[model samples]
Target: MPEGPSKTAEYVATFRAVESARPEGERLFSDPYAASFLDGKLRLGAALARNGMGQRLVCRYIDRNWPGSRPSAVIRTRLIDDAVTAAIEGGAEQLAILGAGYDTRGLRLPAAREIPVFELDQPPTQERKKQRLRARDGDLPSNVTYVPFDLLDEGVGAPLERAGFRTGLKSVYIWEGVLSYLTPEAVDQTLAWITASGAPGSRLVYTYVDVALLKQGGEDEPPWSSQVAKVGEPFRYGLDPAKMDAFLGDRGLKPVWDQSTLEAIAQHAVPGGRNAPGFYRVAEAEVLPDR
Candidate 1:
């Protein structure tokens, strides 16, 4: 992976999104603009992904090097997409993407016109993404705003307020492929902020890995945890799936849907693909009305 804040390892998720819609008949969600974020390199990965062996070779390298990122990237993208769209249809008025690294949903989704999107990340990644977006379209969509957020240094509530996030409008908050890199306490703080800040009936769509595997000698730690640690971005936050409901309830977020890898595979994995227990899961939660 690249050096900091989900650099090279982060881009892999984008590449895998492009791969999801290859060859024609076998496809998942279609993201034509996913390549624009890549500066054209994902097309190369798409070529490599054409055949079974080449695809396996590319994925194998990512697995050995990055550990367990592929499945969550693939599955969570689709699930979050669904959750966000559903939220919007159900009266969501804004989108807040936490750790939004090169994600093009705001640019590509038609509903982007229906609500403003706020992409929050570290400054460097956000700057680069802005430059790339400018080069491709001359300027960003008027409804799309870029916000710099250092999750370690701060949480979203303050930055989002500064960026004009409406506290009264229902919103869909997307926290994908990011919690594992955060400390558990920070995760709790962030979720607490979302629960307390978002309007009643707002929704949060997030992905988190299993906490047991992340702890010392837990039942299902992903083998990639060590490689990820070696790269200096070891996991600090995780949630035991069994306790996830209570965890969210405590934070004033109600679990609406939670999908394990087994369910994701049966529902969305490409036909007969071999994916290790990336154990990453996608969930949707509702902000409880103020009592």
Candidate 2:
């Protein structure tokens, strides 16, 4: 068997494996396609499992604290699920996953099969993902499409639009685990493009970390924040819930949901305690016409 693909592809392939390994765990996210996509990527699977152990530990902690609700992992899963639901409810016929990597929603979700699912990523990332999926005999749903382009390039939007995505129809844009890798300017530009390119009722679900956590001058903070920074993926953009509202408001987006760690834990039944120190944040909003 060919040795999997690029780093990004391998990373995602492993994520699928870990997600699959959780027994009766499919109910957590129910991604049956994960295992198949991970075949032949044993190293990736092992790596993902190693990383996921920490996450699972956190989830277990959250569960001990916030019983009777979904765990933090489930909460994160629902965040994405709700965004997809909102898009469908808003009459969106298309869904675009930016920095798609090895996302399996196009393969696992029935609704995704009904609506066109576009996976956007760099050429190498996209090519490698396709190779892995093909190797596993993974069948992409008929509605799935792949668009390759660098998000930083000015021409990014053109290729997407040319590949059957239109500004006139409602769409859902998912940017999971992506914005942290970008600069503030790039983040703004990406949002601007989505606002300009999506029709009314379209929505965006993206994640980011608090900027205060990124700054060294901040008061007592979690060790994980600094640790993540040392890993070279420091959180660059932090949004004051209010500031985020205003920022998106100016861009014609209506903030529908903003979740803090505690709030997400409560809402999703995550088990970690407040002592665990939350570092990641997720938000969802809709593109509305100028008021």
Candidate 3:
């Protein structure tokens, strides 16, 4: 079957846009270009509007239980924000976003203005996102770059390297909402490449669903997950938190933060409502042994 645009991509764009549009006091994080990217997708926009009820439910649940729960969308935004901030602080000259499907961070984040941001994705998806941004008059940050390639293909790393990514310079790598779409082997291979290619102190921020969650199949499934399953790209990979930490530790990387930590940050940022349970876990690791 020919691979067409995944509905999951559209859903993600909508979710981000909704969260971005929230008022300052109520918002967990912001993505200025999210709404722009979904400009023509009336169905998606409508779906997102309808999902507002679910978001409210999630917010209430988080408020009661977690007290300071950070929705997954907020968690992801903060993770990327931290990664970008850390890269800039550590003097990283480049930033790479893997599987950057319709993501607006490259254009929306102010830190991107100084550090070169490279977005790597398939040609078709990248083209579609580029067109959407252009139509929206979204201003691509001056330092942002786009690399089109299939990460699953052999020699996938070459394009990134050619796009000004170096082996010995501080860098930040983000792979949000991506690993679950890939097979286990591919996930490991991608990690290995990042570990091998990145400079000391480089950081990577990524999210993966828990395998146990997938097996149990509870009411916790995000509304978009079932719809995304209709397409061939159901979530497939889950990282055992303990094993994931050890795996990266062996590669000279140390897990510095996780979902719980972000949840705390969110509590402080947007203190009241029920936040969404983290159906997905986000972690940040640095490319050096723990102190």
lDDT of 3 by residue, 1-291 (tens): 117554456656665665665566666667766665554543344334436574565445434533322345555676677677767777777788998987777666667676778899878778777777777775545677889877677665678888877766777889988887887676777777787787778889887776765775568655445644666677766777768778787667888777743454555454342345444677888888332
| Rank order (by lDDT, best first) | 1, 3, 2
Tell me the spans in candidate 2 whose CA falls farther than 4 Å from its real position: 1-16, 23-26, 36-74, 217-234, 269-276
TM-scores, one per candidate? 0.86, 0.77, 0.81
The better candidate by TM-score, 1 or 3, is 1
The lDDT, on a scale of 0 to 1, for candidate 2 is 0.64
lDDT of each: 0.72, 0.64, 0.67
lDDT of 2 by residue, 9-96 (tens): 4434444444454556333455554454444444443334445575485345434533321233345555687678767766888889
How would you encode candidate 1's per-residue C-alpha lDDT over 213-261 as one tens digit per residue? Answer: 6665454445667656666767777888899778888888788988765
Better of 1 and 2 by TM-score: 1
Which one wins on TM-score? Answer: 1
**Which regions of candidate 1 fall more than 4 Å away from where they truly are?**
1-5, 37-43, 50-68, 216-221, 269-272
Error of 3 at 211 (Å): 1.4
lDDT of 1: 0.72
